[model samples]
Target chain A: MEIIELINVKREFKILNRREGIAGGIKDLFSRDYRYLSAVDDISLKIKKGEIVGYLGPNGAGKSTTIKMMTGILEPTSGKVLVNGKEPYRNRIENAQDIGVVFGQRSQLWWSLPLKESFKVLKEIYQVSDKDYKDMLDLYMSLIDIKNLWDKPVRQMSLGQRTLSDILAAFLHNPSVVYLDEPTIGLDVSMKSKIQEFIKGLNSQKATTIILTTHDMGDVDALCNRIVIIDKGKKLYDDNIENLHKMFGMYRIMKICFSKDVGELDYDSLKDKAAELEKELQENFSGDDMTVSVDEGWIDILMNEEDVSLMEVMNFIQSKQHIYNIKLEEISTEKVIKKIYEGGTIL
Target chain B: MKKRNVKFYLAIYFKIISQDIKSKLSYRVDFIISTMGILFTNIAGFITFWIIFKNFDNINDWNYYEILFLYGFSLMALTPTQCLFDNNWNLRDYVYSGDFIKYCFRPIDLYFYYISEIFDLKGIGEFMMGVGIIVYAWINLKYSVTILGILALIVMWIAASLVMAGIMNIAAATCFWMNNSGYVMVTVFKFTEYTKYPIDIFNKGFRIFFSFIIPIAFVTYYPSMVVLNSHNLPILTIIAPIFSVLFFYISYRIWMFGASRYNGTGT
Candidate 1:
């Protein structure tokens, strides 16, 4: 059974307009100027119990807006969100018990207070059993390695440390689902990895369903098996993250290096080599993200980054004449997003 | 949440308050300076009154000490309000920063989490200064240590303080929408000055407005009227604490309502 469900979840916001000047300001006090904005436009998706799904989108693409609706922060304009068979907005206080959300920019733990104080407050708010509270704390301490920082004030902690505390505070109630929106934003690389590990730990150990919304591709790569991309309030793609690489990011970059400066290649000869390669592929190879350049003691060849794996690229380049150190790398997720942003379709 | 006992809630609040007190004391200069500053505010109020009384002869038949009682009573009535509900000062910041999200996702009532966790020891200074002035005024009023009068004062003052705290929080909770925040307690202290005077000075219309429309009288006027024993204490005075409890529930409801609407923007 699905632990979470959303049927045509939608959200509209009233955009207020103001004419500049004192007169307009006074008039605004008497009457508000507003236009309707459909932030989340008729979105519907479902996650079965214990699934970790990535909610991906560009900035202002209604990603957070959708999460807010599902988490009961914002009520949908035209649809329903059900978590554990309860309407998120109508039964918010009850719905809150079932899910933990850590908004990356907001500190869930009290800033002035120590980390433990915020955890204590959560205990009262959740009414968690004593045994359960201790067990969860123990698990978080292992996951994030923040035992020493427990008594330290939140204001004094580093971004990574604070995020660790926020994550702990969110999950202290042993909630069935966790909603982490950009949970690792602004953290150092080490901290980001730590947060990702802790989240995956919770998902596997507790069978906790997770809806992660983030722009960090590393976070998505590390934690999310399923990716849902939205642009302009519409779902563009929802598929396996690995499959995304196969469908749109299968290209690899192969660079060949020569031991010594290959004496100036004849421009005519290089153009001829390019023409010959184009003909060899019978129109399969094109210079889109592919090009060869000659510089400082080496001739570099860049080609169609495809099914030719990095290992294959290296083996193929190694077998070629006069090649020195050869390098092959898979395209990172950032480039994949660039392709998607430019309206590239994935199979 | 419904089944959770209030005692459990109180225990958590007390724990947070104790933690706050210990943390506050760590900054000793701040602790001493704030207490001194709060005391100075009342001292300023007294000097202002002395200056005015010298000029006016009397304010509607009330003397120096009489006015002092009004001022002291108002100050004391407002002390707990500031001490308890002053934490609501962060309501606007809370909303903008989406800290209320932290409060709402908890299994317990979010309302208790905000009001209970933070304390102002400086208000303790404010509360003590009022106690000092009230003692001086009581002696000047020719009120001996009459057990009945003191007991009535204590009982009425408790109800009055709670009511003031309620009004302060509910007003502050308006930040859920306005988010344009000012000092939660001091900014709207209409009664803190007027509470010392006898309700008689205000016209009947204003008296009704203060008594019910805004309930400012619950803070000082009605309670002092009891201690002075000027007239039979109305049954309505006894009902003030009931209103205090009601205000608390209503304030919590408003706070929780605001808590739900908060969208933590930064995620």
Candidate 2:
């Protein structure tokens, strides 16, 4: 079942054009000049039930706007937005009952109250049954160690703890669809993994459909099976991680560390040596698509694995220098996304 | 959407208010000091009235005790909104900071949820002071009260509170379009001062402006006249309650319109 759908949805904001100087400010009072900026432009999507989808985008790419429309906090300017078969903006209260939202920069929890107090207020607001509330609490407690943080005031808790508590509060009512915007932002590795595990556990246990908007690729890797990428108010790519990798996964990075330090060479001499090495490698592998550069004491090679195998590059580098260590890395999702943003791949 | 009964909202209101009070009381000294500050400020106003009454025989045929009664009644009427709807004053900040989106994300009525987030404990001090002045004036005037009179007073008080709340909500809703509605709210709230005195003392223009345009005169001036039996127009007293309800209904509609136009700040 499709739990969320958007057909050619668009949103535009009227931005005031403020002139310079005091005299210009006075003129602004008399004249209303505005420029319309489209935030979400003619995007269509369908999200199925029990699926965790990563909504990824660059800055100002309309990711937040799309999430806002889905959560019922914003209305699309031109098209239809439906969550659970109801227009979210028109049936906001009903839609809100089944949807939960978490904004990393903005918190919905009561700052001065203890964590549990905020949860109790949410319990009353959502009208969660006592049995259901208790059962949810038990399930969460078993999955994570949050019992100690329950009595701490939200103001005193760290950012990660507060975000954790917020996620718990949002899911306390067992909302069928949850939207997490940058849930892992600014969190340390351990906290991030803990939250990822908790989200994974809840999603499996309840079969809740989750729409996660995040800049962190680790979050996408750990929690999402399908990913949607958007840029500049337009959808660029939408597919599973495996498909995305298969399309752009041929690139690889090979780092070869020299046994001798290259710091003895001057900056100009270092550039000269890197150029010489690049020319030599290109001459040797003429038809291969590759780029070579030299760091402090390491020679780095980025090449398409399909054109030139890792063994060929390693053998060539080994013959040129007394190698101390060699490291091979697959293309990271971050790099693939950066490449997509740079318009290197055709969608 | 499922239609929820009033009982559900009432239960949620009490829960939210109780939590608000609990958090407020955590800072015990701040609560005590602010409450005392409000009490002192109201007492200072009463003292100003006392000084004026000492010099004049009567202001517009109303004696000192009657004016005091009117002042107390105004304060009492203002207290309900003052206690509950204080969050309206921060609507500008909430909208600018994008915090208002949280209310829209909730399953409850936006206005009810917004107001329930805070319960001004300092208004308790204002309530006590108003009641104290009313009791003192009642004893001096030798006013014999009956059950019907008490019921009428309650109705008038509730109607007056609705007028104040309606005005405040309307003013605060302007923040959706403007950069800030703080100045607008303060200017409109200043009109309530005219209710503390006899509306007859004002010129025809001011009287009509307050009565018809803003309807602030109905908040306390005209309602108190009915209670004191000194009203020249009996019809004004009867329509005051109905007019207040109509004003509040219109204000609620305006609020809904403003809310629909709300485009939140950038993330």
Candidate 3:
């Protein structure tokens, strides 16, 4: 069931060391000086069939490079890369038949061709049987409803329409594995959700494995069951989404509503009181990250659930003030990713 | 290894061409102007040739009509190569923009997909002009036409086109390492202009260079020499087909090497 495997892969790119100015340009033409950049360094991963894996990383973190190697567009400089038990770059044409890829920034569709023409061309390239092609079209049309845009040239279509069409083309042949790099990038919220839904639909119907690379955390939350976080060409975290939440996703915001009205509480005195309460709470929950700020009638507290339980946090708050209401909010995945980038270790 | 079905590749090629033409024709004025511009350029080139040959009796024992035949043959060979595989000439852009990545994901042969994906229809005017000049030169020279002669001409034309394609492929492959090789293609294409005249007029070094190093002479000059019954080595001209096959294979190997490097390094 393991459809894709990358074993200790490393890819290095030679950077021509060029200086500025016309004279330098001339000298560079004759210069043999160059430096090598390791883009994907010593990474190993295995992706199983029908599993949606979120290949999450910041820019320049080697997400696309790994996808390229998996899709056979790139060969690792060292180690082994196998898709469906065949070395991808060594058997590219054979590997390509079972894989599909879409770069959100680049369209695989012909610029001047009608959407349908691109589909037909792909049909020939993959040798998709007519019945299967028709069935795919029917299924995709029902999911994304691109039938009306069939005759329109890809150039004239909006970004959402074009990306939708691209996704359809990628899955047209029922590829066993699909690599989607930022497929929802540059689309409106509604369009992004629609694409996410379509992708989910395809995976369920065909049991297709998907490796989605995206900056959108919502996409990762919605689609990916497992997440692989890479930073600077190294795998920092690889676990299911719930575990990521348990590890780095424990920050919570506590908003306390005081029984007293705004006029009754002196702003300066309340601010002083809130600062004193924060210092006391910090000592008790020593390793937990916490902060408190007071408004006219209420105090807002932010702390990590890993160090202090919700009951403990509320007990401290209730001892300080008579609360009329309380609001507890878990940290967003976006903030969790931000914290990961800031060097938060996996639990 | 399972080979791709030829019909499937042909279908992709025709589809790409049709789409390319549609894209070009969408801008009606631009397409017309570009086609007309090429036609005018060819006409002007012929006029310059007429002016030069008017005063000279012959250049290195070849008359004006014979030179016309040479130029016409070069055009016939060059146009098809440039037209069918025009996108290969834009490999610099493809590399810079990373559009080449799309070609890599396909099941088809990379070089085959690269060449077949774009059809420059502006070459139609160039082809028509070439045919007109060739017929005029043939009539004026009164070269006797036989079935074998016609067959030989067709084969020579095919070989010449292959030579041009091979050269273009090599130049495009350089972009894999160089990142920008438009100048390489332009320089090689300009060098082919030397084949439109008698090699004897050029210096001994130039002749040797064109004959062996770059082999532009084999494209039209040598083939024309055999066709005109002026071959110094008549038997050698028969090697054009063999030379073309070798050239194409070597160029393909070079392209594969470059592609592997590209994938390995991603530059």
Candidate 4:
């Protein structure tokens, strides 16, 4: 069943046009100017129960705005936002009862209180049953070693610890839907994997529907079954990860390090050499399915594996210059997203 | 979220407040210093009153003790908002830092959650000082206390507190549009200084403005008049309770409107 649905939702903001310098500042007081910006522009979405969807977007691409509208912190400029079949903004309190939200840049936990105290307050606020609260504590304690953090004030806890506690608090009420905006941001790799494991465990145990907005592709790969990519307030692609891979995964990266030290050349000379090599390769290949660039003394080539094999590209480069090292890489979600941002076709 | 009753809300409020106090008390030195600071500041104001009244017989026929009664009444009226609603001062920071979104995420009233997040314990010192001054002034004036009169005073005190809190809510709500309403809140709150004196000292126009327009006069001056039984318009005392309730309701509506217009800071 659909637990969260957004229909043509849009949010516009009126930003003041602050002028430059002291003189311009003085002039602004007399005649104020504002420009309207559509942060979320007519985006439609449907999220089902127990679905973990990665809401992916580049910076300033309205990912956070869409999450805000879903969480009822923002009322869309037009169109509908329904959570559990109720308009979220109009019925925020009721909607809030059924959902939880965590913004990575902003903490929801009480800064001065301990993790356990904050949990107790949340328990009262959500009216969690005593049995449910105890079960939640037991579940969390069994999954993770969090006893040491129970009495530590949130201000004293490290970033990863605080984030872990925040996630725990968010799921404590067992809300049917949860929104995690950049929850894994700034954590170390091990902590990131641990959090991912915890999230997976909770998802399987409770079947909680999760909408995760993030820049980290690792999180997307580990937690999300479906991915929705957006750009500049427009929906670019929304599909299961496998389908996305099948469509964009044919591309491969070839990194070739030449025995000649390209670092000895100036940046301009290096750019000129890269451009010359790219032109020669394009003329030889006679196809637009490949891109070549120079990075840190290595000539990196990204091309569709179907159009040209890795062995062909490596052999051509090796014949021209003595090869020091060579590496091949399959396309990842990260590279695919970069390609999409570079205006690649969705299909 | 559900159809919660008043008792449920009150219980949750105490729960949150107790946790807030526990966190605040953790910083022992800071807590003591702030409480002492508030106590000293109020004592300094009382000393100024003492120095002024020592030279003059009275200001506009109001004696020193009478003025003390009014001052004490004003402080008592201000205490509830100071202790319970002091978190309104942090609204600007919350909005600017994008922390206000946390309040919206909770399954509770936004205003209730915001206010419950902090309880300024220093207001306890202010309350004790206010009560001490009121008792001292009452003894000096030899005012007889009756059960009915005490009940009336309690009602007026609650009304006065609502008036102060309503004004504060209106000032804080401007943060939604302005992004920072510190100056507005401070300037509006400074007007509370007028409540510590008799409205008769001001000109007729200023007196009318304070009583009707800004309503600070209703907070302490008019209420004190009713207590002292020297009120020319006893009807104002009756209207004070209703006016305070309506004033708070309107202010809450303004806050809700501002909250709806809240465009959170950039991600």
Each prediction's RMSD over C-alphas, in Å, is 6.2, 4.2, 5.5, 3.3
Best by DockQ: 4
- Model 3, docking class: acceptable
Please state what fraction of the native interface contacts candidate 2 reproduces: 0.62
- Model 2 lDDT tens row, B20-136: 788889889999999999989988988898999999979999999999999999999899889999999988898888778777788988888777777888898888888888888
Candidate 4 positional error at B145, Å: 2.5
Question: Per-residue lDDT for B39-127 in model 1, tens only?
Answer: 88778877887787889867888777877787778878888867877778777776776556666565556676667756777887777
**DockQ, computed on Cα atoms, for candidate 3:** 0.39
The native-contact fraction of candidate 3 is 0.68
Deviating ranges (above 4 Å) for candidate 2: A14-35, A255-326, A344-346, B230-234
* lDDT for B210 (candidate 3): 86
Instruction: Rank candidates, TM-score, best first.
Output: 4, 2, 3, 1
Q: Model 3 TM-score? A: 0.86
Q: In candidate 2, how many Å is residue B212 off?
A: 2.8
Score chain A of each prediction against the true chain A by TM-score and list the results.
0.77, 0.86, 0.80, 0.88
Computed on alpha carbons, the lDDT of every model, listed in order, comes to 0.74, 0.85, 0.82, 0.85
For residues A1-347, write the lDDT of model 1, one tens digit per residue: 88888888778888678778999888887777688888887777888888889888788888878877777767888988888888887866678888898878777666667788867866876788899998987777666678778789888888778877888877888888898888889988887887788889988888888889888889988998898888777777788877887764556645455444445555566556545533543343444554444434334444445533445444544555556556656656755675676663533
| TM-scores of the candidates in the order shown | 0.83, 0.88, 0.86, 0.91
Please name the candidate that would achieve the greatest TM-score relative to the true structure.
4
DockQ of each: 0.36, 0.46, 0.39, 0.55
